[model samples]
Target chain A: MLKSAKRFALTAALALAAGPALGGALGLGSEARPEEVTAWDIDVRPDGQGLPEGGGTVEQGEMLFQERCTACHGEFGEGAGRWPVLAGGYDTLDSDNPVKTIGSYWPHLSTVYDYIRRAMPFGDAQSLTADETYALTAYLLYLNEIVAEDFELTKENFTSIELSNESGFIPDDRPDTPGLSEREPCMTDCKPEVVIRMRARVLDVTPDTEDTSAVTSD
Target chain B: MSTSRKPQGGTTRRGFLSAAGGAALAAGAIRPAVSAGPENLPPNVPGWSRYLGSGVDAYPYGQPSSFESHVVRRNVAWLTASVESSVNFTPLHELDGIITPNGLCFERHHAGIAEVDPSDYRLMINGLVDKPMIFTLDDIKRFPRTNKIFFLECAANSGMEWRGAQLNGCQFTHGMVHCVMYTGVPLKLILEEAGLKTNAKWLMVEGADAAGMNRSVPLDKALDDCMVAFKMNGEALRPEQGYPLRLVVPGWEGNMWIKWLRRIEVGDQPWHTREETSKYTDLLENGKSRRFTWAMDCKSVITSPSPQAPLLHKGHNILSGIAWSGRGTVDRVDVTLDGGRNWRPARIDGPSFDKAVHRFYFEFDWQGESLLLQSRAIDSTGYVQPTKDELRAVRGTNSIYHNNGIQTWHVRGNGEVENVEVS
Candidate 1:
């Protein structure tokens, strides 16, 4: 009797928690305190808003980049073997397989600033100051030949810098095209292309690695 | 007279390891426990407590036990060109319970894990939004919170199984999946905050990894049941599992969850980024590629009593494994020892949440005979688990993603288990 009563109460609460009866597409729950949790995602738009406040010249950026970034990212912004190439590749997106780089493929310069400030220098992340980030950004632009050797990267001039692939991003407009009518939702009678049966061929039987390096482990 | 064969003729890997040890323990050396009463108590193993470990002060962050040292995501050094291009597997054989400890979650990176700090982070919701808003991690957490356990699987999981039985252990063949509980606010809250314009429909979420992997998620899916998670398993997410923040698209492919999530560009349509164009979409035998594929189908596996993790007890033993669905709750799990011949309804146990892991158990006695073990899942949506042939009938061998079919485990009389394919 007690277990049934408890179940009744729990079920009632769950139904209430699932939100109002009719609207949810998947009956998913919503948040209550939607404002307090700030998602610090430094994603600036093509319009140049949301860029941080900082300034630095290409000359100063050169010194800072050499000291902190050169080892992994090459003397200029040519990146290490495994690390990404940061400078060139201005017009490669049209190729069969483009080698996308900063000045060429990135849609927004703010992303460059945001990325360098967040993660760079390989192991040590978020070590550069805002000023250092701006300088490095300017230096990277110089290497990519986007900015002149003497150009300074200031909050004021940040907007003037335009990326080559700024226009490459096209939003998905599948059935959402202008004249689309109602479509069938994948609730039922869903059709798929392929079906998998038993797993067959095996590739590699996970050979044990020999880590001879006296690498420290966490 | 051995407890080895009640449902009869199945021996475990551990039982095969030390046949002498089983005899020693079964003898008076064991402080046998009865069905009830004081005889059930036994001395605890030294240095180990009844519970694993006491969680520290309010787990603003938490991690797996220090004792679980070997349980980690391991990568095959030669799986790809180099470590950078390779993938890692989560050790599923050693884990129990539905929630995979965060540290053990598998990681697959085209480049490497990008470390993004929360302070300098700012998420811009623009493109087609009426009012573009740049949010901080705090802004995302402030909104109402929800919690649910869901499995995140790399689409490439078990992709190597396309050929023949190459990988010996089930861990390598099936470790690309893990389930964890997330703590965070809903994606709807942020969409509302950014003020989705009337025309705003699709959302393109991008990660901060070196490759900046991006995927176009439809707005309907975003507003319904998606979370921008900051914590996993009661703590800040591990660096490998998208520290700072990540998008939790329940019951969807892992790549769509976008680690180190940096942007949510609301748009009137989808973004045909490099990630969507060149990869993820499966090539069909008919020369077309299956695109915009989302929901992960129902899948189950007999994790134990399989290669790498073999049976031990020669007597009464319990067969346990995980079952789940990306569509809805798992209603039932069926076990087949003779390769789907006489199926038995396995007992479902533990918390039952939609788009989450469900644990199931089957108790039976084993005899010293070779056998085949397999499991099939039935979701709440009435989607019955299909056979490999049935799945292969639709999604041809050319496809690599969404291979949720029955997996078989072959156990030999010697108690050694091998990965098997029962056609």
Candidate 2:
């Protein structure tokens, strides 16, 4: 009888919380334990909100990167094949072949630590300790000439070290373009001359159709 | 499987043509107007009519006709380092109407497909919530459900064509987008169940994939239209499309729709994750970049009469294409046949849903002259799809994503089509 009374009270609370407009909650799902939230809260913000207590040096990062990342990111973070280049490319953002690297393009240092901590080491992810991630981030900074070889990175100084392109990003201000007119779009004689500026046949970069496996073979 | 014997000396029209020789086929000679004109005519019954068909359960789950086996997703190998972390293009030229079939939706995986078992799936809501909650797949289903049709488009759909017309087919140039009807519960109900705190302004939704793909979304948008979808087109979601459950951020770039959804953390500030920073962010030519450019601009493409689907006849051709907008429904689509010399409104023939794909077509009589075909889309916002040159003038050629420029297809007199750029 006492348990039945408690259930009735819980249902009443749920209905009041949901409000009449929403028709009340169905009273599903269990309250999550503190341990469950701790296990999944891995994100780190620009203001160093979720960082753990850890520190590592650039020397340690170099060794760790060589052992775990060089196969894909290259020995000096120059990148292998189409893999991401983690270092250098400080001022190439405006050039034709803009090589955006950690030092050049990334705005906040927290992203480097978060990415390495969440998903890194290529095939293997979430396998690194906080110390290892900090070390790898410091090593990348040193490789990009942002830090000295002996510089160490810690949670306390994580926000102090800013990336070069921190001021590069702006909010989306689209429809900022010109040429779109309020008048009806041109239908007849929009351009005086029609010239073929480029053709895909000339470049011929499309994959060969013959190489594609036939679906019927399955 | 061998239900009948082969007909003696079965000389069908196609068989007769093939038996003639290579020269007859190469020169485009002796090609009948209709392939089934000979034995399959009304006077003589076709071979299939005489034979017994396959019994029930031949395929427990049905498949497309074998004749349409060529319709399949394709990928450009050199675009990425490995197949595990790459993308594939949908066979857009072969598809019609607005709904993309389940299997043909283009896939872009950061670290391959994660095969998650339904029994093991769990979605947790925590951080800044009055009461943190953990729910199994069954628990999520108990909430009120809604059905919405929305198009999920990768921001890099036309990214490769930023500089010029490089890819030969529409499949490569504009196949990174797909439309589907999703059935799921409104994310607001789930968040309300967890009871949001006053400080909750942003949400960090993370997936359970090996890449652990995550993105920060403003709480306003989450409450407006976001969904926790577990089914697509009235069926359970495909494994590649985040089986069990996935977040649906309608009208936004596809990356923000985190698949294999696992957790949602309410926060006060954006996380600035790798996807938002190191990638997805548009790099302008002036060294400044555009971050959080979420909504896909109004875009359209001529699916047929493209490089892959060339013109086969000289008269009465139906030019078909697709148009969509991330902000709202497509309002109008215009077609140009003479390199912008003349334009006419194409007939939109399907149901118009907000932030969903719209199908359009223009029927014309072709007289075998060379033609330059282009289609322009205008959305509810009156935003006209810009020309490649016009877009280049503003954003420059460096911003690889969101190249919603009008595409040009050159149709030769020989009934062959080629991807081209016009000035």
Candidate 3:
């Protein structure tokens, strides 16, 4: 009993020497202060975690989005010149050309909030305030017809806003890819005859190469 | 030397070429002398051998021979809006062996390359840890280090060919991959140094680029073969690659290997960031999307006899390609000479490391006939590479990522090659 008490006291002394409030063993890194954590911890979860106390209306979002966004994301989030289209494409996931936007494809609204706050305006990132991010989120929802033009988005009501495609995503069930495993590579007579269905030369999309000597094989 | 046979410098050569007899030889209507001059051909010494060559230190850093200028990374102009947010394809056709040269590796940037000063770089380990530590570049180097080789392939390596055969060359089709040796400390060691809390289950790794690109990596993968790599191919990380540091997530998509790595935050649950949700997610034929699909399936492609590197001579052609898998090592790679009609096991050459690119070759004597060529790779897990039809039937044509379907190159009768799809 005396030995066990001495061991506990030794452990307590080592913890004190480490100078860590949480008393971790390695004691390699400096303690992260609250302010430092707040500065870098910008991610937002579906459950409304990591959201700062702020609010913005759809009207405010529309004005801000046009001023900051719309160069690449388009005026109505339709996208311009191969940039990402943020809105529309309500039911095009199953089609040959699925226009994946924040409304038609994204399963969560928190992703929209976190993305706008984290990286937007293309070149300038991390420049959006908490309220501005909320406003942008509101405006994007309004564009997608998820919320009304006058609807306001706040930290308290952020979790209440459920995405239309919330149940559309499934975990990777690959090897669920048909014929992936069952394919037995055949050596001879794999098929009777081979026929070409399409050629890239017909499309003429491939850029011409500078090396013309490739035509001559030694 | 005889006056009649003496070599003239410029005027006589031009006058000779202008003559009818010389014109026929120049036009290939008649045979010309094989050697430029008889003195330089046989017992006499060549110009290079006769003269003293350039001395050492001509170049502080070495480069490929001037004759090899064609082996370079190329970008398709029509693919992206700007070069800043674009990708460059590696010249896979020209490369031999498994190790991709540091300069020739393909580049993919969302917000362009970032030039980071190693002195100012800091990696912070925060959230759900007993101690949230900040590591300087020097501090990171002090830890126990390991050397590993792995292939980093973009999730959208063959996304363009999903609908049909689009790109002509294998470089443009499947050059978004590069395998290299890395020197770094195990990520688990760093995480252990910080001391993870009981609730720590996921990690959010963020980069320092203008995009501030971030992704959620499960702790299971973090504890696996992940590394905080500072050097690639025995040199400091190239600025285009990451510079100071980058996370090396083996067997996962290249994007998840966060470059210019800055922060790693531990948490209980995943943060469904923009990249994981809207972009990298694969849309299935059923209209539902597949999230957190990290691993690249088994894939292979013939680099030679491809559209860019066409068959030149009919005989003694060396057909070569690269094969790899995310789950494990590639056990076998089969080559199809008549499309998928007949398959012959190609000889697997070079190092066959886990999750690294494996080189293979097939030597055949060509008879100058039109040929449809393809290659299929099988990983150690018994998973065979799928055909384009097989992939499209399952995932549909809407996917913009993870298109590892078999690639086909049609070698025409005139020694020309073009990308084609066959049934």
Could you say which candidate leads in lDDT?
2
* Over 4 Å off, model 2: A1-24, A178-181, A210-218, B1-37
Clashing pairs in 3: none
Candidate with the larger TM-score of 1 and 3: 3
Candidate with the larger TM-score of 2 and 3: 2
Docking band of candidate 3:
acceptable
TM-score of chain B of each: 0.84, 0.92, 0.91
Query: By lDDT, is 2 or 3 better?
Result: 2
Worst 10 residues of 1 chain B by lDDT: B1-10
Clashing pairs in 2: none
DockQ of each: 0.07, 0.37, 0.39
> Taking the tens digit of each residue's C-alpha lDDT, what string does model 1 give over A64-115?
8889887767886677765566778654544433455676656667667755
Write one digit per residue (lDDT tens) for candidate 3, span B132-168.
7788898888776789999999999988888788888
Tens digits of per-residue lDDT for model 1, B280-335 = 65544443445666777777887777666666657677888888888889988888
Give residue B90's error in model 3 in angstroms. 0.9
Pairing residues by index, what is the TM-score of model 3? Answer: 0.89
What shift in Å separates residue A27 of candidate 3 from its native position after superposition?
5.5
Error of 2 at A94 (Å): 0.8
